[model samples]
Target chain A: MINEEINEIQNIEIRLFLEALFQRYDYDFRNYSQAHIKRRILHRMNLNNFKNISEMQHRILYDPSFVQQILLDLSINVTEMYRDPSFYAAVRKEVIPILKTYPFIKTWHAGCSTGEEVYSMAILMREEGLLNRSQIYATDFNHKVLKIAKEGIYPIDQIKDYTTNYQKSGGKESFSSYYDANYNSVIIDSSLKKNIVFADHNLVTDSVFAEVNLIICRNVLIYFNRELQDKVIKLFLDSLAPGGILCLGSKENLQYSTHFEMFSVIDAHEKIYRKEYRH
Target chain B: MIEQKSFPIYKPLAIVIGTSAGGVEALTKIFIGLRAGFSIPILVVQHISPSSDSYLPKHLNRLTTVSVNEAIDKTSIEEFNAYLAPPNYHMLVEEDRTISLTVDEKVSYARPSIDVLFETASRAYGRNLLGVIMTGANADGASGSKLLREMGGFLVVQDPKSAHISTMPEAALQLAGADYVTNLEGIIEFLNQLK
Candidate 1:
C-alpha cells in the first residue's frame, strides 16, 4: 500500500513537472496523454542521473542545454527507409494512375523524419516517369534531422536489407544501382533527390503552406491527442487539392475526423485516401 | 555466521541494451530475475527482420515485474519500465520531449537497428546512461557501444563464451572495450543491487 502511494506521488510529481516544463519552456506537452509524458520525462531524468524529478525540474528551469536534452528525449524520432513497403507499393499501383493524369505534381510529406520516405517517393516518381515534373516537399519539426535527411547518406551495411525492401516495394531496377557505397556509408543517388526540398515544419503548431496534389503524413499523427490529431487532419484537408491523394500510417485513419467526408479510400489495406471533388 | 555487508547501490537512469540472433533466450534469462519495482527505464533494440513481429516485450512482461511495451511514437520514457523497438523501425529519442519515428532506411540490415538506438541514446544521455551488449551472430552493436563508453556511459557485455551465439559479444568487446564483461546471472545480480 505504501509502495502504491509512492507510485501515485511520483506520478503526480511528473505531471506537475510537465506542467512546469510547459510554463517555463513554452514547449506544449499539455495535450499529450499523462502516461506517455510521464514515461518520457522519467526516462530523461534517469538518463541525466537525477535522483528525482525535482532535481530534473530545477536543472531544466535554469539550464537551456538541459532543456534541449529533455526535448531530444521527448521527441519520437524512430523511423526507417522503405518502412511498410506495401504502403509504397499501394501508392505505386493505386495512386500513380491518377497522379499520371496530371501534367505536374506537388506532394508534401509532413513529419518526414530524416527524409527516407521523401526519397522513396522521389524514386517511385522517377520510375513512373514523373520525376522531372514533380516537386516533393519533405518536412519535419527537428532541424538537425532535416540536415541529415538532406545528406541522404545511410550505413552501407544496411543496403542488402533495404534492397529487399526495395524489391518488395516493386523496384524496377537493381537496388544497388541507386547508391554508391563509400566504405561504411551509402550515399543515395543525387538524381532521386533533385526535385526534393527538405524543410522544418511542425504539424502541431504550424499551418499549411501550399495547395498540394498529394499529402503523405504517415506515422506522425498517432503521437498527438485526439484534438491535435484533428487539427492536423484539418490542416491536411486544407492543404490537399481537390481529388488529391492522402496517405497515412497503418494504424491511423480519417474516420470520425471532421474531414472524413471530404475524402474516400483509395486503398483501405494501405490506408491510402483520396480527396473527393465536389463538382 | 558471517553477515554480508549491503553495498551502496547505484541506479542507472537510462539502460541501453543490444542483441542479435539468439538474443531472445539470452534476454529472457537476464530479465527473468529482475526484482519487482525496479525503477530504471530500459531501451533495447534486438536485431529482427523488417517483417518480424516482436512478442519479446509481451513475453518479458510476463516473466518480469516491470511494465514492458513496444516503444511508441511520442511515448514518454518512464521509470520501472522496458521498451523494445518494434520491427522495421529504428527507435531513436529526439532532442525534444517526443518520440520520432523515421523510415530513413535500415542500418546493418535491421530496422529496429541496435546501433541507431545505442548511438542516439548515448548522444542523448551521455554519462548518465548504462549500456549492455549481449549475444548475437553479428557485429552490429560494437561501434555504438564504443561510442557509449567514450561518452562516459557505463558498459556491460555478456560473456562471449557463455552466449549461445558469441559473435556479437566478441565483436563488442573487441570494438567497445567493455568495462564489465559477465554472464547472464551476474547481470541479474548487478541489476538487483541497483534495485
Candidate 2:
C-alpha cells in the first residue's frame, strides 16, 4: 500500500485512541494539537513496544495503570521557574502595576504544570507585597503533578537556574529566601505557600471555578489546536474580571482567534493582553 | 544551460529544506527561483542562534515573491509561502497540515531541529514531499533524509564541492543517496520549473 494510505489509516487509529482515552477516562485530549499528541503517542508506543496505535488503545481501554502513563506523556510539563526571564521582567514592568490597582486580587494559573509557574508568580507577588491580599488558584487536569505543585519541592540543582531567572526578572529579595534546601530537594517556604491553592481542573473539560483578575496560562495553550485554543481563550475571557490581564506563551497569539478584538495588547512581544473594560 | 534529464520528474506537494552555517545566503539563493506562481509550500529548518530574534523570515521576505514567515504554533500551512521554524523551538507538521512547535529537548544538538522537521514532514507528506539539504556546518539532516527516501520521497543534495560548507549535504549524500545533486543555480532552475 502507498504511504499516504498507511498514513491515513494511522491517523484514524490515533483518533480512535484519543476517543477511547476520553470515553474510558474522563480526560479529553481530542482537541489537543494533532502534531503534539501524535508525537507523544508515537513516543509512548515505541517505548512500550506497542506494534500499532490500536494496540496502545486496547491497552488504554483495559489498563488503568497504562492510561496513567499516557496521561503524563500527553501533558506538556516541560516548564521551569521564570521561563523566558524577559517575559517575567515584562510582567513585572507592565502587568504588576495593573495588578497593584486591585485591592483584593485573585489570579488563576491554568495548566500550572508541576506548579513551577504558580510558585514563580507567588514569589513575584510576595516580593511586591501583593501575596497578603492575593488568592492564587493553580489548576491542572493531572492530579499527580498538582500534588507535586502543592508540595512545592523541587530538586536542589534546579535552584541555580531558578535563581538566575529570578534575578533577571527584577526580583528584589534574595532568591534563597523563598525556599529551604533539605539534602536533595528544596522546599518552598510557608510564607510563599500561604495564599496559593492547587487543584485539579481540566481546561478542556471544566468550567471556570472563580472570577480571577490575572489569568496566566503560558505555553500550555500551544499544545491545543486553533479551535481548542480559541475555546480556552474564551474561557479565560469569561473567567477574568473586566480589564483582567491574560498572558500566553511566547509562540502563541490571538491573531487567528475569533475573539481577537476583545483584548488589547499591553506588550505585543511578551504576548500579554488586557481585556477591554467595555461590555 | 541544463539538460531535462538532470531534474527529477516527480511533482511534490511540499518541500522541506534543511540548512545551517551559510543558511541565510544559501536559502536566499534558492528562494530567488520562487516566482509568484510557485505554489508548493516550503518548510524550512535553519540553524539559527538560540538567543537570536526570528528575523530570518522577515529578512528573506524582501527578496522572494513567496511570503516568508516564522512558524506559529497551531497555524495551518499554506501554499506559495515559506515557513521558517522559529528560534528555540522544534517545528513539526501534523496530518491535518498544520504546524506545531515544541520545546521538548533538542535533538542532534539543535532546537528548531532539521531532523525533527524532516521526519514529521515525511510522515505528513510521504512520497509527495521533496527533501533538500544545503550547505551547513552540522550533520543534522542525514538520518531524516534517509527516512525521507525510505518513505519514497525524493532527496536533493547541494553538490558538496560547490557548497559554502559541505558538511550537511555531504552527510545527507553519504547516508541518503541524492535523487539529484546540483549547485545553487541548478537548484534554482529546478525550483522554477515546479508546477
Candidate 3:
C-alpha cells in the first residue's frame, strides 16, 4: 500500500483509541491537538514497551493501570515558578492597579499544572497586600499534579531558577523567605498557602466554576486544537466578571477566538486582556 | 546525483528542512534561489535560542519568493509558504496537515527539534515528503532523516565540505544515508526543478 493509505488507516486506529478512552474513562482528549496527542501516545507507547499505537490501544481498553500512565503522558506537566518572568512583571505593573481597585478579588489559574504559577501569583498578590482580600482557585485535570501543587514542595535544585525568576519579576522579599528548605525539597511557606484552593478541574470537560476577577490560564490552551481553544476561550469569557483581566500564555493570542471582541487587549505582548462590559 | 532516477517523480506534497549552527545563512541561500510558483509547503526547524524573536522568519521572508512565517499553533500548512518553527516549541505536522506546537520536553537539548518535525511530517506526508538535513553542529536530524527514508520519503543532505558546520550533515550522511549529498547551490538547483 502507498504511505498515504497506511497513514489513513493509522489515523483511524488513533481516533478509535481516543474514542475508546473517552467512552471508557470520562477523560475527553478528543479535542486536543491531533498532532500533539499522537506524539504523546507514541511516546507513551514507547515507554510502556509497546510496539505500535494499536497495541497500546488494546491495553488501554483492558488495563486500567495503563490508562493512568497514558493520562499522565497526555497532560503536560512541564512548568516552573514565575515561568516567563516578564509575564509576572506585566501582571504586577499592568494588572495590579486594576486589581487594587476591587474590594475583594477572585482569581482562577486554570490548568495550573503543578501549581508553580499558582504560588507565583499568590506571592505577587501578597506583596501587593491583596492576598488578604483575594481568593485564588488553582485547578488542573491531573489530580496527581494538583496534589503536588497543593503541597507546594519543589525540588531544592529548582529554587535557584525560581529565585532568579522571582527577583526578575520584582519580588519584594527574599525568595528564601517564602520556602522552608528541607534536605532535598523546599516546602513553600504555609502563610503563603492561605486563601488558595487547589482542585481538579478539566478545561475540556468542566464548565465555569466561579466568576473570577482575574483568570490566568497561561500556556494551557496551546495544547488544544483551534476548535477547543475557541470553546475554552468562550468559557473564560463566561467565567470572567465584567472588566476581569484574562492572562494567557505568552505564545497564545485572542486573534482567532470568536469571542475576540469581548475582551480588550491590556498588554498585547504579555497576552493580557480585559473583558468588555455588556451593553 | 543529478540523475533522472534520483529526483522524486510523485509531485512532492511537503518539504521538511532541518538545520542548526549555520542554518540562517545556508537556508537564506537555498530560499533565495527558490523561484515563485513552487507550491509544496515547507516546514523548517532552525535551532534557535528559546528566548529569540521571530526575526528569522521575517528576515527569510524578505529574501525568498515564498511567504515565510513563524509557525503558529493550530495553523494549517499552506502551499507556497515556508513555516519556521517558533523558538522553544517542538513543531509537528498533524495527519490533518495542520501545524501543532508543543512545549513538551526538549529532544537533543532543543525544543524546536528537527527530529520531531521530520518524524511527524513523515507520518503525515509519507513518501510525498521531502526531507533535507543541512549544516549544523549536532546530530539532531540524523534519526529523523532515517525515519523519513524508512517511510519511503526522499532524503538529501548538504555536502559537508560546503557546509558552514560539517558535523550535522556529516552525521546525517554516516547515519541516515541520503539519496543525494550536494552543496547549497546544488540543493537550490534540485529544489527549483521539483515540478
Q: Which RMSD values do the candidates have, in order?
A: 9.7, 3.0, 2.1
lDDT of 3 by residue, A1-279 (tens): 776676677678889999989999999999888878877787777776887778888898999887778888888888999988989999999999999999999999999988999999999999999999998999998888999999999999999999999999999999998999999999999988889998889889989989999999987888888899999999999999999999998778898889999999999988999999983
lDDT accuracy of residue A4 in candidate 3: 65
Q: In model 1, what is the error at residue A101, expressed in angstroms?
A: 1.1
Candidate 3 regions with alpha-carbon error over 4 angstroms = A1-3, B1-5, B36-39
Candidate lDDT values, in order: 0.77, 0.87, 0.89
Pairs with steric clashes in candidate 3? none
- What is the descending DockQ order? 3, 2, 1
Model 2 Cα displacement at A227 (Å)?
1.7
Off by over 4 Å in 2: A182-184, B1-6, B32-39, B161-167
Interface RMSD after interface superposition, each candidate: 10.2, 1.6, 1.7
* Number of backbone collisions per candidate: 34, 0, 0
**What is the lDDT for B12 in model 2?**
91
Residue A59's C-alpha lDDT in candidate 1?
Answer: 81
Model 1 lDDT per residue over B80-114, tens place: 78888877666776434234444434666777677
lDDT per residue for candidate 1 within A30-146, as digits (tens), equals: 665443455567667777688888888788788877776676666666666777888888888899999999999999999887777788888888889998999899998777778
